[model samples]
Target chain A: MNMSLKNTLKMAIKSILSNKMRTFLTMLGIIIGVFSVIVMVSMGQGATASVTQSIEGMGSNLLNITLTDRTIRFSNDNLSELSMLEGVHMLSPNINWVAPVKYGLNNEAGTSVVGVNENYMVINGYTMMTGRLINPLDIENRNKVVLLGSEVSESLFGQFNPIGESISLSGIKYTVVGVLEENENTLFGDNNNMVLVPYTTGMRQFRTNSIASITIQGTDAASIDKTQSKIETYLMTLYGTDTYRIFNQEQLLSTLNEITGVLTLLLGGIAGISLLVGGIGIMNIMLVTVSERTREIGVRKAIGARRSNILFQFLIESSVISGIGGIIGIMLGILVNRIISTAFEIPISASMQVILIAFLFSLFIGVFFGMYPANKASKLKPVDALRYE
Target chain B: MILLDKVTKTYIMGEIELTVLKGISIDVREGDFFSIIGPSGSGKSTLMNILGCLDVPTSGEYYLDGQEISTYSENDLAKIRNEKIGFIFQKFNLLPKLDAFENVELPLIYRGIKSKRRKEETEIALDSVGLYDRMHHKPNELSGGQQQRVAIARALVGNPSVLLADEPTGNLDTKSGNEVLDILESLNRKGRTIIVITHDFEVADRSKTEITLRDGIIVNRKVK
Candidate 1:
């Protein structure tokens, strides 16, 4: 004789419903375990995504090179030659000088003043809030002109329009060109805290005729790698190997992803322990339930219940409990991700794949842990069970 | 309809191996109402267990419907109990969660009967015991007499060849006990072969045949 799975499930549900409090307590472990796992993974993915996004926004088709060899120097002729290289769209000498900056009464002893040319506006991700950018004429006439970053503008002008105004840098008055928009804070230093000046003025300020740092914008992603290798070859002849280092967005993105990937797994592993404990909880409760219902098992067996029927009855009960808990955990996890992501603006990655994996794992826990108790119940002797009292 | 040849039963408790039933033999024809009367510890319960197929004999041959059952496995015994023997317990062992109709319908569910046929047979069995209106009531909602009637319905729903009742009225009031005894006699009058295990003369007096057992052996036999 065969018992339908539907009837067995019905009976299991009836038993679970009879003891509402204990069943819910058993299910709590699975819910909390699944919820934490989903949230932790989303957080790790969100961090990785935000990093990649900021780097991509900064333009992936660019090369940043810093010269470490102090013996070699880039003359004006050498700068011209490098700019004329194939696939080089634009180039800006990225020279940083920390010096005293003052606007009438305001004075800061160590403020970062960066040097750039006309193409620097397009090469770096910068947008003007007011006034104009440095022009080629300012570099030719060696005129002192500076663009104020959002933070620099706030410190120098105090809400007053700084465009067309003059600020003293290194004891020299330079006319302010424009104020830049506020930029997002990222791992790669803040662009809002610096002041930009013409490279000619900056070279004069640093008292160095040769440029040390350069930011080159390539034509596109396909040609950037080719341009980098060619530049590296030429730079070796000048600065030598291990003397000059270059950075690319693709390399940085890969490294960031690798770190986040490991972090995500670590979080998942920790969460998995809780899920394992939940399964053990189910097994413990199920064993107790089997022993408690000994007489019931005897009655069913006396009435002709096969071992398979009894096995399914208990197995289905455990699955239903954990399955319902899993659904609640998934919804709660997504809700938590939504709340946290909104509270702190970040792109949290929550994919259906993770949800599916967690759900299936919970169901697996039900079956795996329920096996022992169910088998014990099914194998009970009808005579002994009936006489168990 | 039933046959047993020197059937024996023993239980081992630690180092002491005690024989509950030394040797027993019996034969009952089809449609015969049989009764096994004995005092407590006289092996009547053990004999009933063997007859109900809930257990096996220590040694000897048992035949039911011309099929040798002493060598049957546990699963085979379960099937034989399902298809051939119906047991009515003194405690009215109904699962507390289910209603009267569900309790009566359980055996058919295990028998893998379709829902329509199961419903039909369950209704008929409950109606035969005059508890059709109380089918929806749970065990705790009914009195002792009504609970026993429901148990009878459960025992009859499977349409087994013989009904094996162990102390059918052992835990009932005088009136409730008489009511259960009347139901058992009426079922037997309908040509349902029944065997009742009891120590009470009041229960044995109604049966067509009685076998008095003492210390696991038949001491007297009466055929009326």
Candidate 2:
């Protein structure tokens, strides 16, 4: 019911509607700009979300201790004493190497041979699908008992229980004790392509004297930092500086999120440049329109339209163009996100924050670009304008 | 009511100084059907521009209803034009994009009148111009005469104190020209002040008082 505003808006809409194809063409730039911005940002955030979820799935309380030097060795008694530290829930000293696995005529190349103990299954969150995991007695007796990952079990003993079946780790015979269920949340690599055996058995087979890598699970997420520091201080006393490194899961997660956040910002910035170009397009068209309608502006002025009235008329016109373009861009962005998500099997939802920012920035572009031309139109001498042929 | 005292307008087109209106004086009282006739280069168009509040004279005073507004700001002049002056141009000056109804509604809209009142005023103006039935037609859809009538409706919509017509009937055929003259006469009879600037003596002869201008100066006057 604001009389002048309503009147101005009606006039602007009429002028814009008069040139359907030209207006649409002008809007195309903004549409593509907003579309790209939304899609790129959503992809970055989607990647971040999946990676963060997988890492958190393994539990934030886990710590990985690596002995960089081959000379440094940790015995079974030394690892057990570290597990008794405050806020430490569990610990597994692991020795791992890659070799071919064979059972009968079936051979799976590049099988990950992981040496672990009774605490390994619980700490790494592996659940047995059949049979039992390697027990404490297996380590003392140095028995060649192993647990088969789901994929290894499938290849080495298809459709049949791999329990009690003997498999060879590079020509050494090992009895299969259990087959692990399929797990999809492994951060480093596919846990389903690995073999689990007692550390003592692996040491003898691989001929290594030291256990270099160790995984520890804290009692709770809040205690992970404290327990890691305690273990670091304890390790410093044993091996001193530069000989060992402890990787914290929470730190890794944060570092990954930071990287994705920067990438998203970078993509959004590139898309914003396109939007700025689209704004220039609006200005170009608006300038052309002002000149073309010079006589009309004079007539309006003669009929008593104020300079401000004429100014707002063209400004509203450009804003309307960009506003509508932004809406279409958003709808298209969501649609494209859907198509891509389906094609690549990645879950992508265009972030609402990004959508809202793009919409508002587009409107701002309209007004900013429209100012010069509208001012030119408003300042025209009525007599000269009316005389324009 | 309108009065001009010794008004002059100068144009400096890149050091070629030209004085279009050289100390021209004009007067017209309320409800008067006044005409100023001159050929091209006679400065009548410049005089009309000044009277219409579209431009100001370089030197001298312009008084509308006894208020000296020759030195008014651009914004003030716009207000005077909007509320006290109505314009009808030879080209019809109807915004081609707007239909007859919207054309008539423009002045009231500029005046910031409410929609309901503006609609009522526009309807009345279009009815008086005898274009009520064709109010929905655009400028292109209407005949030359009908387009001129819509221009007249637009001029009359704001109920301005003076109607300034710069060759209102110049684009029309003889019959349509006379039709416009007749409407002007009738409206003048109804006590509305009107001023017509034209190069045609016949058009001047229809007015109650007429003047002839040659070389930016009024040379003669006739009481018709």
Candidate 3:
């Protein structure tokens, strides 16, 4: 008989609604399957995004050089020679130490102190919010002038301008010459929490003649590789050992991307196993539904329902179950992602493509798993089915 | 019109061969009301099933309106059942999930009738069976007689050439049974062919013609 698809869908929905608990129980598996996949992929995407942002925060055409051998120090003449190297656009020698600072009644314990030259602000992508940055005179004369990060200034002098104010650091008095801008896209926490001083003053106070690290920007994006290899060869010859590591922004970003990509796929694969289980659950429930509705099948057949009609009816029913489950799962996945991102303070990126793929997979699972039961229903003999209690 | 020529049905259980109908022949004309009466295991149900196109005989030449349906494929027989035969079961097999209107509309839906025409035909069929007032009531909410009437409406809604009822009043009270028999008689009078299968003589007596079956053969045939 020529049964309309609309009528079959109506019948399927009616039957599904008639058994609410069974339908819900069957849908639970699919819901969980879709939920886990979305959540895992979203979190993975978030991690990848965070890593990319951090790598990009280091400056696009910048390279980092950390000296593992403390004995090898870059002298002022050596720094000038390296600065004039081909493909090197700008260079900043830096040192780091931790010391306590006190301004009036506000005291910061173990505050990070960074020693840098005039090129520090340019290479590190820092902008001035209020005062000028440290000049070359500050480094040349070993002047005891310091620049406070935005956060350090806020903590030391709330609502009051701290420029030109004198603060004691490690029992030595220093004047605050400037306050750096508050960078919102800082990779590792707030860069606004540290103090910046001249490398000469930091070297004398910390009792160190060795430079801690060097940051350099290439003349252009294409020149970064040449500059990086030149510096690596120079440092290797000077130290006579491979005691330093050089990393560029592109290398770090690509490595992070690869790691996150593999992690995302692994997580999605684990969740896919649950989806398979969910498909099996649907098949199990569909088989039971067919068996339970055998008499109804017989009645429909006797009323002139063709085998195709019965097959389509059952197939639509299972698809509706999974389709609804997929929708709910998508919503639940978004909600769970929001909750997790908020709780952990991580940025989650749940793309539209992921949601669409998850939904389509659920539908496919429904059709794939539903085939056997629908075929079984269609192959039933009217007489035997009618006789089935 | 229905014609059966030397129709035989057999069932093989392990090493035993059980023949239910041994070359039984029967002819039912248009606008005729007939009853087939038999005791249990007399092959009357088997014959009803074959006539309703619910089963194919082991060997036979069964014709409905000059079509050789005994040799038709399963799908073809299903189409014939959909277009030419309407069935009423003894237990009032109205889908419990559907109301009376939907139950009656089932056959029309299978026929791919549009909703507007299907609703109109369903209403007319329910009105004819006197269940129009209870058309919105589900099977469980209706009395046994009302459910049977709804089943009859479902059978009549398709406008089939033959109405084959298998003990239509078997599960009803005497008053309800008589009401169903009266409806069948009235439908027959309206130029609709009706066949009732029952072992009860009282039920058989309501029909204009009666055939009694014994051991897979017709023992008696009477026309009143």
Candidate 4:
């Protein structure tokens, strides 16, 4: 607030403004540094958020169990016993096949036909839009009953009622018992373009008794890990080897979060190199400034400027340059983030902590790199400085 | 008042020891208009630097206003330069970036003076140098003599104990040089102590006392 400091600051601004091109060139490094950091971290955050949303959509407290060994197979009796294990709330065996489906004169190829048990609708959080879902009797009697997903019904029957209609798959005609509601949380395009059939009927039709995968739900969130270990142990006993992989949603999510977190940090580190380079650029320009203004330093010294005064003037000048660069870089970074979000249609989360850190780090870079040149300016003797040509 | 007792200055350039000033002694009292005349490398500049507190004596004592400043630190010397000595250089030394008014206010800014007082003093100094109307012109925009006048105003704005001018009119034509000399004469008439260092006899003739130097020693001293 003192006049000396104020005047020094004014001098600094005037000098920096006088050399506009050089100042801007010096700031380019920091601008690029901050921009890349924000964009990369934001993209990482977007990826994490999308993966989390998709995982949560599958249902919380859900576990997927897959058998890697083709030789080992699960019988109905074995699956029922596995369902009775501790912490197990529900379990559904699934088998997937691609087939051409026809209803009326309309036909669709590569229509995903999923074979699931009666509990599949409940365990996978599928909602019934019309008619009724597959009941236990449908699974027990190996009935040729089917549920149509919203997209499948739309493709085959258009606006007409799909329930009580017959859809033929692989020359087998099955009555559509119900249609599933559209799942908005589906990540891989549309999950609605599918048909669900009773596991028994699908096994008979597809001539494959081997189940592809099983989805299980724990009693609650806290019991998922315990349920996962129990299922692993039960499978190990049945197959005499650990060939099955049990993926719990919570564990998988945390691992995903860890990977993305490291990725974000790595991105920030790479961007930090440019910031360091930017600091060096400032130092280089400041040294040139000090030398170029050598006579000015001498004149100031002769006019009674203390060593500290000269030091502070140059220090303030460099800090102002980097501070302004930091602000501009932040704005550019946010702009880049906006561009990416709009272009990709992915919502990016911007954390305030990251922005604050980037700004402060830039300022620190100014002070840190500005020290040498300012010190050199301050240490010049009045007589020698005045004599400097 | 300024006094030197057997002051000597030696500079070590690599292995060569060059003594620019060797056992020189002189005295100038308050209200005295003095000039130091010498040829190139005669240590006149060395004496000026010591008198202005820009450099210290190597093996002798220096007194400024009864204070022994020979042993003063760089910081203390800076304060003495700020508070006690005003320097007017041959090149004018006005910062190119600052206009006349800001350049004149620079010494007072270093003194931590309030803006109101600084403005008042700067105006008086510029008016004294007859550059009040041209206070907003930068150094490059002004003629050489006008720039020197601005430098003189900067030197006097802080009201230092003495004005030490090194070739104040060295770069100007005869008319502009005489104009600067007239200003120094009038300022001396107002009881401001002035010291002019030059090789020009015409410039030295205006001072009441003159010291002639040759080979780092004062060979002649004259009083009007």
Candidate 5:
């Protein structure tokens, strides 16, 4: 509340306001820099939520197994024992391989050939757009029938119904049983693209016995922990090793969260570089201001303004600039998030803590970077300064 | 009262040494109207800078109101300038952003005077200079004569012991310059210790006492 400070602030504001275009152009660097940070961070957060929600949408009990320098073995002759274990609900075994699909003489596409039991649709929560899902009788008769993903079906059959149409999988012909509806998710998840086929038919067509993965559904929401433990114990005892990893719904959800967390940090750090550049721009402008206002500084000093008063004046000016930039950047970021959420169907949530953090960070940048110029201005001798032409 | 005992000041440019005031000394009592007249580069400005406590002599002693201020630090010198002396520059260095009242109230702000009392004192000072009606007008809106008057009001607001005028009329026309000189003479007549620095003999003749400098030395003195 010192008068010198009050006067100094008043004068600084008037000076900046008097030159509108120059002030706007000077603030442009901070605007772009802050805008880049806010937009990048918000978009990254939206993308992460999209990916996590997609993974969550895929049934919670899905578990993946990839063999890495270790052999996978199971002693159960049939799959009935796995179903009988405590807290065990149902098991859907899977086998996967790549195959080229053909619809007509010229239309062709490459897709993943997945071997799944009839319970695959039930455990994975997939709906059929046309025809029916895989059945036990089809597996028993070893029928040459396959289901296509929405994308795959559209690419191969066009507007014509693909329920009775014939398609090729690995040089073998199979009738199209159904096409699964497209699930809402991103490219980061595993269900975006694939072709589903009967287990026995897929084994005969590809000639391989390797089980790629197994998904076990829980009895109810309350029995998740029991089911996960039961599945892990049964698998360990059967295989005589605990090398295979077992995951339940909560673990899968947390894994997705962890990945998204890393992505958010990476994006935030990358955007922070631009904020640093903007801070440097402010510092550079302050140094020039100090040079141009040498005589003014002398006048103030001679008029009895303290050194700290001068420093605060410049610091406030820079902080005000950065503060305004932060405000505009936040608005722009929200606008971008809304547009993207509308363009592509997704959900985005921005937290108030993020805005507060960005504002405080910009203020810190102003003070930290403004130190050099403020000190340089404060150190100028009143005598030499006044004599300066 | 102000006293300067054998004061000497020197300047160094690159490697060469130049002395501006060589063992000059003077003393003046309070409420004295005095003029220091000299041509360009006669060390008058340098001596005025020292007398105003804006600069410390390289050697010898200076006393203001019986306090040895030659050894005072920069901060102490600033306090003395704020509390004891008011300066009027030739350029009428009013902050261009501020109006006449703000410029006049500046020293009171440094004196830590309360706002209400400071406003009262500022009004009185501006009215004394015939600028009370134009207190809100900025320097850009005022002519050279009016600006100098505002500057003089600014110097008088704090009721300092001495009013230091350094070529106060140098930048004004003949009529405006005479107006400023008349104001200075009136302030001096009111028993304020007023010291003016000028090269115009006519302006110097208006003061009660005139001290002339030649080659950095005081050569003649006349009492009007």
Candidate 6:
């Protein structure tokens, strides 16, 4: 360290020590700003991680096609057409219902009903826990056989095994063929509270050909984009642009990630404003310090010290103030982030680039704001300075 | 050695010119213990500032040793001050943040002296002022007399050709003030050319030569 810098650092530390309250107050703005950025970014990153994990759990490389309007009908013919696509590995058309099932009195009343095909279990990676899944023969004969999810089985059968047991849906009796295992990674909603019936049985009972959504599994990761493109082209060519909607799960995930990134930056940018305020605080305090030390400036000048020396002394003082504050703020921010992460089940990470940028920016703030005050102190006429009371 | 020929300095208040030092001339040889005694507003301070290179005369010639310094730029004047002269102030203007050793080492620092050499020279200078033991004490921690001694030590550290003191004991008790004057006399006796500015006749009596000023002009000179 240069001599003047050593002295200036000593003086700056002393100045801060002498006025503890003021120093802390000056540091408060920076602390809050840094703390806000760390917490916001950590929460945002955790939320995005949860989303990605949920997407991966829902069967990898999956696509969803929903036919919402009556005019956008995709019947057996359309399903065959989609199945013909080379990249599409499987196409499972689904029909859904919400039939309230009951076993005992008021305590056992519940509604858990789902209507889907036998292929949905295989394509969506679901397996039967008891009896076999509904076969193509059951759908062709329109037999009233059903499969119950684990929770639905327990709700309607009261602890007994529900396989081969009969349950009433819309006052019509159907025999339960199997129970599905509980899904542990349900993010959107409770996937295990659902029940599935053969597609023909659902259409025969509900009397509607309205399909809820289509699940398509691609042959491989590379073929997903091609499969999606082919589906979009087929749907648009067959039913026009406004008829159906196609959503790629990967695209949805990336868009969500983009939103999280924007949120992190916006939070960080808003937090950056307080650093600017802290810089202004340093400037104001330095101005006061220069005035208070005018006599010292004169004494040094009168005793063979040059103008540059006086300027350097004051500059170092202000720079050290802000620089120390910046370091302390960074440390405090990380500490608070860790505490929050522990409480909220999230990980908080700060890049080395961010630390370096914050440190250098604070240094620049010191030099930029300190220049005016240091120059003012240096330019004072020695005689006038000495004459100051 | 110092020489001044027809030096004039003026201050402008709005439009009217206020001349402080009107056509003054004087000379002093090396190793002289000289005093300039004057009443308030008698221009002694202005002349001291000019001699110390803190101010330039509005008109005149000034030569220190053999070099003309009256027309030097501010930067050049500062360089000359750093290389050839040291100043002691009436208030014993020690920097409050610094201890005695650091204050004394300041002049050498400006001269770009290495820290090891500056420390050695500072120690010797403070020792000469009888303040080596108190070298780590800040100005506020020391007595007025000790602060003035540290100021003198600071002046001596650079080994300058001239030591200029302006009312060096202006803010002390007589006992402390006398102690400072005694130190200044001893420094002069050891061959550091010293000049003191004071209005007190008793303080002026300590010098070997005294010049009295009144209303911007030298009125009398006594060789003691």
Worst 10 residues of 4 chain A by lDDT: A182-191
lDDT winner between candidates 3 and 4: 3
lDDT values of the candidates? 0.89, 0.90, 0.89, 0.89, 0.79, 0.80
lDDT accuracy of residue A96 in candidate 3: 81
DockQ of 1: 0.64
Evaluate model 5 with DockQ and give the value.
Answer: 0.26
Angstrom error at residue A292, model 1: 2.9
The TM-score of candidate 1 is: 0.81
Instruction: Give lDDT: candidate 2, residue A368.
Output: 94
DockQ list for all candidates: 0.64, 0.49, 0.57, 0.46, 0.26, 0.36
| i-RMS, each model, one decimal | 0.9, 2.6, 1.0, 2.6, 2.9, 3.4
Supply candidate 5's per-residue lDDT for A62: 53
Could you tell which candidate, 4 or 6, scores higher by DockQ? 4
Docking class of 5: acceptable
lDDT by residue for model 5 (B1-224), tens: 88889889999899998999887777777888889999999999898888887778989899898999999977787778877788888988888878999889988876778879999999999999999999999999999999999999988988889999999999999999999999988888889999999998888888888888877788988886
For candidate 5, the per-residue lDDT at A174 reads 93
Candidate 3 runs further than 4 Å off: A59-252
lDDT tens digits by residue: candidate 1, B1-224: 99999999999999999898888999977888999999999999999999988889999889999999988887788788888888899899999999999999999999899999999999999999999999999999999989999999999999999999999899899999999999999999989999999999999999999999999999999999
Q: Model 2 over residues A1-389: C-alpha lDDT tens digits? A: 12367677888889999999999998998898888888888888899899888889888889999988778788777788898889899888788889899999999999999999899989888899999988889988999998999999998889987789898999999999899999884768999999999998999889988788999999998878888889988998887988888999999999999998998889889988998999999999999999999999999889888888889999999999998888998899999999999999999878778889989999998899999999999999999999999
What is candidate 4's lDDT per residue for A80-134, written digit by digit as tens? 8989999999999878889999987899989989899888889988899999989
Name every residue pair that clashes in candidate 2.
none
In angstroms, give how far residue A239 of model 5 lies from its true place: 7.3
What's the TM-score of each model vs. the native?
Answer: 0.81, 0.83, 0.74, 0.77, 0.73, 0.75
- Cα lDDT tens digits for candidate 6, B63-177: 9989999889766887788878888888888878778998888878767777788889999999998999999998999999999999998888888898899999999899999
User: What 10-residue stretch in candidate 2 chain B is worst by lDDT?
Assistant: B106-115
In Å, residue B107's CA in model 3 sits off its true spot by 0.9
Clashes of each: 0, 0, 0, 0, 0, 0
| TM-score of the first chain alone, every candidate | 0.79, 0.79, 0.67, 0.75, 0.65, 0.73
